[model samples]
Target: MAKIAFILLCHKDPDAVIKQAQSLTAVGDYMAIHFDARAPKAAYDRIRKALADNPNVAFAKRRVKCGWGEWSLVQATLNAVETAVEAFPRASHFYMLSGDCMAIKSAEYAHAFLDQRDVDYIESFDYFHSDWIKTGWKEERLIYRHWFNERTQKKRFYAMFNLQKRLGMTREIPGDLEVMIGSQWWCLRRRTVEWILEFCRTRPDVLRFFRTTWIPDETFFQTLVRHLVPEHEIESRALTFLMFTDYGMPVVFYNDHYDLLLAQDFLFARKISPEARELKRRLGVLYASEGARFQISNEGQSLFRFLTGKGRIGRRFAPRFWEAESSLGRERELLIVLCKKWHVAKRLTARIRALTNIPCIEYLFNEAGCDLPDLGGIQSSMSKRHRHRRALMRMLFEYYDTERLVICLDPQNLDLLEDFCRDRSVSRLLEIECQFTDAYLGGHAMRVGLAGERTPKETLNRLLPTIRNDIVHESDRIRDAQFDNHLRIREIDPPDVNARALAAFLSLPEDIARELANTDHLFAD
Candidate 1:
């Protein structure tokens, strides 16, 4: 018979560990359990007693404390694999599982599946395009921004820097290599397992460096596999379809119930608290029913079935829902204004642009509505304020038409636009209010009245023409409003300054406004 080694490195949760190991007993498999040496002796003894009846079980050599974000977990895993290989030399494959992982299907099905693959089943993925790197980094930085939190800031910063270095980011940057990330849980052929162990042995210093590192469990195996065999066949998705515990148990979902010694399902149906005897009674009924093999109905009956085991019967089902794609190609031209300093708005805008492909035209406002210099080109300047606004305006009008009119906004200054439009139009506008305090990680309040009823595409389409008409009206209003007021404001005291600034700024409208006005451009009309 083909043999498989189930290697598990566990700490603290011995009862949970033994419960997981016991499920494997049905398959007549051999297992190597490495309980961290640091665990309490009484706890360790309890685990040993639980598995004493199993003839295929053996204690692993040595013990190691596994710390999250530290390399000790990886080390313990490596140690367990070595011991398993030594004890089960005849085994064809080795599956690395956690104390929390439960087998969803029968062991026979799992074994057959692995045999067919003829490759290690490691869940690996390209990390370069991960949104985690962006959002996680931003969150970490924000946590460090408070003046009172200098000590914590230094620690997190160092951790990030160390992580960047270990992933081979030293000196000259290479374009070909991408960071690999995945769940540490995986199954590997015996040869693959041996190769990994041998590689780590050959490079002792590399292992030593990662020993003190943070979140090393995720990186250590990934880095080693990438370095050893960069083109190895690895699965990019998880193998099991079971719900995992926060502690990492992969509890088996059985169809039948034996006398309620243990309930091994992804999730327990009935509560087993306060009254153990009653819980056992329900479990006995469940076990006798062969794991309650029933399909759930479409009308939220699955939750009821899974929880109470008393629900309307029907076939299994999943709901259909539409998920929005990143706005890569489709972007409306936009002009963003900010009441705050340019730097604050620039960072916010960069994040927004990264999230969406929307084109942006930015403006900054002081007490007076005088035009500020373009700051886009200068690295030291926050806003891209140096670019020719007239050129940008022409591009927006020429390429974009009614299908895509520009978005003009002061995300920080909603007051300026309050009187600019009618109450209804203002109501339709999307106003996102963000908090600026460290305690509150900036809450967003979107004022999308009737627009909320429409899909994003429809909302954009409906709003575009209204924005174009408003921009033209505003340009005319600003010029007319400034004719006499120019003399009062010292910035434009010269008679020619009013027309000159407005002419340069409004040049594109003079050319395209009439063309746009003549066209039947309203979305509804």
Candidate 2:
């Protein structure tokens, strides 16, 4: 059996780690887990119990609490590598992963990819030129600068910052080679790990510098790789591109195009639930068949139902609205309802626009019909009747801008008002509704509904700060409103509202400028 040692530094998400291990074990692979020593004993025990049946698995000796820009994580990973090498000397490759990450490919394909490379597959690219010595100095400077700006002790912080800057300036001229920085995830040949161990053991200066440096994990590995094997090709992207994210934790998307079997090949993985297992099995069988490979025929019709069935009943019933709209195609009027009740809508719109190039006309109900032409006949029975009229006005204005007549339908009136959008020239009016009935009824639920084991509370807490920050940075009018509210609210000792208003003012997006005028937590309980 071709041996491959998978190393994981787990803190949170033990369940995810266990499920990932189960997937790897199913594919006949050896695994090694290192639970963070600082994590709860119950968590450690749970992980240990989960992997107890697998003879190939063994726990690491020492655990470390890893912090960003800290060296302890680097040391812990190094220790894991050393331990894995000793236990599985015949193992051809070693893969490093975090507790939260997941594999996209099966073990067999993963091994084949690594075998072809023969070198490490870790992303390490420089933003500047290769010969830029200042890059290294600047990286070091940035660490201290961040510390000084954010730290509590003013005098001591500046003192250390100045001292570091001076030392960085006087440090020996850096080599023609540049620092290689990339994703922490890497698949390395066993020989490469051995070579790295030997280099770290003998290099006293490198060791000494890493122990004190702020960016130990990134800088240490980068400097070491650059100095040792400058010519080796390192993969610039994550092996599993599906889990990649611009901000926040990496998330996996299970789609028909992606092969679920390949996920077993990943070095580290988050969990796959029972629902995902069924989906994977159905997809695997569908894809495995010869006739299904050419095209999704009548014979494979059951596959679509199997994959998209279960809780996607509403999706099955609803028409494919998104299918007709091209991302780049211009529309006459894109009417957007900035509802006072859906705070998550504001955040979701900003996030969507940032990720995709989609554009829309955002208008609050209060300001909707003021400057815009009222095409009339837009009414709804919802608590906010005036808001629906404003939505109609906004849609009318957008229609004028696009030179295409389009209608905006509020959720309350969508079913009854199909005639408004039935005209060939009229673009379809899209309604953003909550698929999760439980979340919809719960006032505190995020605008974006929860999916698979995730609670509305957790999702909202994670997303709210980002939404608030984006809104504040995008709008100055909101800032002024917040300032006025702060003066008035603080006098009455209403700190919570004041703080919330300030946060909203600072973070509300410019595109949703009219939305913040109400200053109420739309999703709050």
Report the alpha-carbon TM-score of model 2 versus the true structure.
0.46
lDDT on C-alpha atoms for all candidate structures: 0.45, 0.48
Looking at model 2, report the run of 10 residues with the lowest lDDT sum.
Answer: 292-301
Which candidate should be chosen as best, given lDDT against the real structure? 2
Q: Model 1: per-residue lDDT, tens digit, 1-525?
A: 446788877776776667567656545667888888778988989988988888767677777765555556777888788888887777777777766444433455455557776666665655555453333442232122121212445676576665755674433212333445666766677877888899777877566555544455665676566655636466544453333333444333332322211312222222122223343344334322332332211111222132333122232232112212212123332232321223333443344344334443345332223233333433223232222223333334444342222233543233333322211111112221222331111111013121222223332343345434433444343344332212111121332432232222223333332232222311110
Count of clashing residue pairs in every prediction? 28, 17
